[model samples]
Target: MEEDSMDYTVFLEAKQLRKQAEDDAKLLSNRLALLRMEEQKALKKIEETRRKAQEIMEARIRNQELLKEKEEKERLKQEEERLKLLEIQNTKAQDRMQREQRVEGCKAKNRYEAKELKEKMQENLEIAERKKQEELEIKTNMKNQIKTQKSLAQEKRRLMNEAKKAQAREELERRIREQEQIRRNYEDSVSRMEQEELELIQRLQNTQLMQQSVYEDLEEAMRS
Candidate 1:
């Protein structure tokens, strides 16, 4: 009866262990599912950020191209105006050359006008160069922004991976501890059972010896 009770208790413990294992498995599965969902969300966010960056880059390129086209048109227009002015000055100089007294004055006027036109052209070139530099800086800033976004995404992924690793490690440690405890409990129960059996055997041997001594004493008394 005692052995049967011990077997029943062991059965209960085994059942409980199985239930605990199932529960732990379920919990791990839930955690994994949640992590996967979060990973998907992070991936989605990264993709969206990339898409926006790509769109912004393309828009900026288009704007830059348009700006270049507008500047080129303006430059051509200025060149045309300068050529017209030069032609007008050449015609007036030719007319003044036909009159000796006025020739020097016309020559002076032409030199001044030429100097002014040259200064205007130089200023326009400087302005164009400044605009080009600004555009370059803007492009550089956009690239840096894209790079920063990429770095952030990578960091987030790295953190997620680390979190998963930590969780897995913790679960492994917990299972190991539980298994060790179960082993210890089993060993203790076995040791206790062995001790009890040894004690019972010793008691039985003592009881048999006492009975034999009593019988011998009875037999001797009858003979007398």
Candidate 2:
């Protein structure tokens, strides 16, 4: 009976050791499963972060493209405005030049008319002087031919009649006065025309200066 009790004690010790080892193995397996689950969750979080970063980068690139496009549109609009302004300035300058040319032409025409008038007046004066000289020569020849009293008396009577009839000197003086009046009138007209032309040129210059000032203001505004 002693030997049998010893054997039974040994058997009981062995069985308890086996049961403890099995419980330890079960705990280790559970810990390993939990660690795997945590690793998977971390991997998923990393993938989500990476995807968000990629989306943000793409959005930034798209925004940059949009900004570039907007800038290009603004530049084109400014260029168009500049071209329009240039065209306006060129047109105004052309109009001013044409007006100046017309003013010069008018001045030339006035000068030509005045010259023609002067020449006509001088020609008339010369003709009147020539006729008076011819009449004086004839009168002197007739006076030399008187040789008798009767002839002299007849010549005197003729001379008296001619003196009463001939108003050449008066007519000549009247024509001279008329020529002087015409010259004065022409000079007055020329003065008036010149004054009017000067006023017109001044007005044109003032308008040009105003337009230039306006253009400069527009340029300043655009720059600002």
Candidate 3:
């Protein structure tokens, strides 16, 4: 009886241990299932976070490209403005140079005209002095002849008249030739002065036309 009871107790203990092991196995399985579900949720969260990060990165890159493009446009605009300002400065400088050249040319021409007028006045004075000397010599010769005595003077006068008439005719002819030469020289001087004035007018007109052309070109460029 004691041996049978001992065997029965041992069997019962074995059965209880088996039941406890089975319960522990089931609890472990439930924990493993719950851990798997949590792992899947973590994976989904990681994927969402990675997607959001990729989107953020793409947006940052796009923004950088836009910023660089804006900067480039701003730089190009500034460069164009600088070139325009430089061109304007160059044009103004050229205009000033042309104006100075015109002023200098006019001053030189005025000086030349004044010099020519002075020389013409000197020539006229010389011509008048020469004519006055010729008249004085004729008056002195007539006075000396009148002082000679009556009978001797009459015989001398008849001989003198014949020679005097021939000399008078020659003098008149020479005087006429000199008068014609003086008239020709006066006419030529007048014609030359007229031509020089015409040339000066033409040059002024040409300069004005050139200035107009430059202004028109500048206007066109500004419009463009």
Candidate 4:
């Protein structure tokens, strides 16, 4: 009867130890499952970061292309303006040459008329003086027109330079902003990855400790 009682007690103790081991195993399995889930989440986050980085790079490339295109347009516009100024200068030069030729012809005709009208010297003198006055007026008008065109051209050049400076400032500011944003994003990704790695390491350490404790408990039960 005593032996039977001892056997029954031993059996009960063995059954209880088995139940505890089973519970511990189930808990460890659950922890491993949770760790796998966390790992999956970390991987997903890493992939998302990579995608964002790729998008940012593409955007930067596009911005560079746009900048180049704008610069080309500005260059073309400047060239066109230069050509227009040249044309205007050429036209002015032609008009001046024509006016000088007309004045010389008039002078020659006046000389012939004076020689033919020696008896009407006073009348010829008056006509010659009027012609000289008309020539002087034409010269004065031509000088004024040239001065006005020069001033207008200078003003146009100044305006173009100011516009170019403004555009350069804006472009520089935009590039700075983009670089700052990229830097922030990179730092954030690195920080997040480090945090996730630390968490995974800590979870693995905890699992190792739990396994060690379970092994110790099993060993102790066997000894008992």
Candidate 5:
């Protein structure tokens, strides 16, 4: 009965050890899965961030060109207004009725000049707008090129991370296999120990039985 109880205890211990190893394996698997998921999420965020940055840079360049063109147009308009005012003031300074005729010619000349100025202003505004549009387009194209380069860099980084993760996963698998082999080795040792203990107990019981039989035979011989 003692031998049977001892074997049962050894079996229970072995079972518990196996359970512990299995739990550890499961935990490692879960950790690996979580890490892989986090890595993927990081890669996706990097891509998105890069794309947004590119778009913002393009917008900024276009805005700058448009602003410069608008300022140029406003400057030309102000200059035209100043010229018109100066011409009007000059005619106002003339006084006599005979001078009125000469002033009238000057007035017609001023009107013609004002008309030319208006046309010139219009032409300048159109030119400025066209130049601004062209500049904006060029800037946008340059921004796109920059963005493409940056995106490629980000992709490279992401791929590197993925490669590292794969390496880690393989390493983890190897470690797990090593651990499993160790567990099996430990289990084999435990089994061998239990067998040895059982054999020792059986040998001790057999020795005790032989001594008891010898004493009984000696007692019978004395009675005879």
Candidate 6:
């Protein structure tokens, strides 16, 4: 009975130790599996973060390109506006030059008109003086004619009052002498008056011709 009991006790102790070792090995295997699962989860999270970061960087690059394009368009528009304004300024300068030239032309025309008017006034004054001189000459000629006629009549009356009819031939000769003297004086006076009147008439014709010529010249000049 003692040997059998000792053998059985040893066997029971060995079985209990083997069972404990097997339980410890199973616990180690479970911990290793849990660590592997946690490592996989961490790697998945890191990949997701990297993908989101790449997306953000790409979006920023596209926004930068759009902003650059918009800035370029705005710069071009501003340059166009500046060029348009420069053209307008040049046009205004040209207009001002034309206006100045027109004003200068008007001033020259006014000066010419003033000179022409002054010349016409001088011509009119000369014509008035010539007319007054002609009137004075006519009055002088009429007075001379009246005096000659009065002297002839008084000589004839004196001859009749003497009653010297002895020689009819002498009386007739004396009468003829008186008549010839009066006729010669009257003819000389008429010749002088006729010459002066012809000269006056010629002057008037020349003045009329000059005026007509001036008017024709003015018409041709205006047409030109």
- Find the candidate with the highest lDDT and give its number: 4
lDDT of candidate 2 over 97-150, digit per residue (tens): 999999999999999999999999999999999999999999987777665666
Candidate 5: regions farther than 4 A off: 1-166, 210-224
Clashing pairs in 6: none
Q: lDDT tens digits, residues 1-224, model 6?
A: 57556545655555555555555555655555565555555555555555555566677789999989999999999999999999998999999999999999999999999999999999999999999999999999889989998998899888876756645545545555555554555555455555655665565556556555555654554454
Q: On residues 1-224, what C-alpha lDDT tens digit does candidate 5 reach at each position?
A: 57556555655565666667665555555555565555555555555555555566677789999989999999999999999999888766755556878878998999999999999999999999999999999999999999899999999999998799678656655555555666786666555555655665565556556555555654554454
List candidate 1 stretches off by more than 4 Å: 1-9, 58-224
Residue-by-residue lDDT tens digits, candidate 1, 37-153: 555555555555555556656877898899899999999999999999999989998777668767777889999999999999999999999999999999999999999999999
The top-ranked prediction according to TM-score is 4
Put down candidate 3 lDDT per residue, 1-224, tens digits, no spaces: 57556555655555555555555555555555565555555555555555555665687789989989999999999999999999998998999999999999999999999999999999999999999999999899878767655667788979997899678656655555555555555555555555655665565556556555555654554454
RMSD of each: 40.7, 59.2, 61.4, 37.6, 38.3, 73.0
Candidate 2 residue runs with Cα over 4 Å from true position: 1-9, 55-224
Cα lDDT of candidate 2 equals: 0.67
Clashing pairs for predicted structure model 5, backbone only: none
Candidate 3: what lDDT? 0.68
* TM-score of every candidate: 0.23, 0.22, 0.22, 0.24, 0.22, 0.21
Residue pairs with clashing backbones, model 1:
none
The clash count of every prediction, one per candidate, is: 0, 0, 0, 0, 0, 0
- What candidate 3 gets wrong by more than 4 Å, as runs, is 1-5, 58-224
* Candidate 3 positional error at 100, Å: 88
lDDT of each: 0.69, 0.67, 0.68, 0.70, 0.69, 0.68
